[model samples]
Target: MLRLSAQHLHELAQYAGDHGVRVVTENWFALLDRPAEVLHLLEALDGEVGLLLDFGNWTGERKYADLAQIARLAESTHAKANYDADGNLQTADYAHCLKICADAGFQGPHSLIFDSAGDEWTEIAKLRDFVLAAL
Candidate 1:
C-alpha cells in the first residue's frame, strides 16, 4: 500500500516482513531533505519491505534529490505520469525516473498511477521495461 510518510517506514517494513505481506511505502520525498535518515531506515529494512517511490510526489520541495537515492530505498515504485508546476499538470519525466531506478539496480515492477487514458497496465509495462533495462 502507498503510505504517507517515511517516519514509519522501518516499523511498517518490519511489520510487513513479519506478516508476510509485501510492503511498499510512498510520500518518500517527505524525507528527502534528510536523506541520511532515509538511508538509515532503508538500510535497516528487511528485504521483504519495498518502496512505491514516486517522482511526481517529489516535486514540491525536494525536487533535486536525484533518482539513485530514491532507488536505493525502493523495491517497487509508483510510476506517476504527470508533472505539476504551480499545480498545473504537465508531462512527467518518466524516462529519467526510470533511469534513476535503473542505475540503482532495482529489478521490480513499477506500479502505475492513472493518467490520461491508461490503467496500471501501461505504467506497469513501462516499469517492467525499466526493471529489465536497469538490471
Candidate 2:
C-alpha cells in the first residue's frame, strides 16, 4: 500500500486519462476522518484516486462510523475478507457493505478477498469467483 501511496497513486491520478487504471483502491480508515482533510487530499489527486472500501481493516471505532465520507470517493471497492475457522467466509452482512457502495453511486465489479497470506492470488481468485457467482 505504501508503494502505491508515495508513487503509484499520485502518478496514476496524474496519468489517468492515459491508463486503463483510471480508478484505485485504498485503505479507508488510513485516510483522515475529518472530512476537510480527506477532501483536500482527494481534491489534490487526479481522477484516478478513487476509494476501495475494505471491510476488514478499519479500527473498531471507525468501523461503525457512518459510510458517508468514504462512500463519497468510491468508484470501485473491495470487500476484503472475514473468514471463519474453516477458512470459509464469516457470516457477516457483506450485502450491507455492498449497499453502502451502491448507495454512494458506485457500480463495481468489486473484489472479495480471501487469504492475504502466501499465494493469495489463487485464493483471491477463488473467492472472487465465488463472490461473483453469489452476486
Candidate 3:
C-alpha cells in the first residue's frame, strides 16, 4: 500500500511539474504520518515532491521526534495552533514545534492555521505574531 501510494504521488507530482506546479504533501495523512513512512515515500519519489509539514499533525509521545526527523525536508509548513475560547495560545507546544523546525534548518514560510471561534483576522494576526516570536 505504501509503495502504491508513493507511485501515485510520483505520477501526480510529475504531471504537476509538467505544468510548472510544485507538488507537496502534508503529514496529516495517516499512511504518511510516521517518520519512517515519510522517509520511505520520499525515497520512492526520489525527493521529487516537497513536504508541507503541519505542526498539528502526529500526536503522542514521539510527535516531536517524528516532526524533527522530517522538518528538514519541508519546503513549507502549516503553523497550526490550538487556541482557547478566550484566544490564549498554547505557547509551549507551538513554540516547541517551531524550535524543532528551526533546529532542523527549515527555512520556509509558516502558513498559519487557526480555526478557533473568534474574529478570523484577529486570530490570524495573533497566530502570526506568536509564530514570529517563537521562530
Top-scoring candidate (TM-score):
3
Q: Write the per-residue lDDT of candidate 3 for residues 3-53, one digit (tens) a residue.
A: 898888999999999999999988865788799888888888997888999
- Model 1 off-target regions past 4 Å? 1-15, 27-34, 44-48, 60-64, 83-92, 115-135
Candidate structures ordered by lDDT, highest first: 3, 2, 1
Taking the tens digit of each residue's C-alpha lDDT, what string does model 2 give over 12-124?
Answer: 66677576556565654555444444555566664547666666655445453545567767665667666666666554545556556666776666766665454677777
Off by more than 4 A, model 3: 85-87
Per-residue alpha-carbon lDDT of model 1 for 1-135, expressed as tens digits?
223444466577667778887776554544543456555555555444556667667664445354556576676777675635543224346666767777778777676665544455765576566545644
Model 3 quality (TM-score): 0.93
Per-residue lDDT, model 2, residue 4, is 44
Q: 1 or 2: which has the higher TM-score?
A: 2
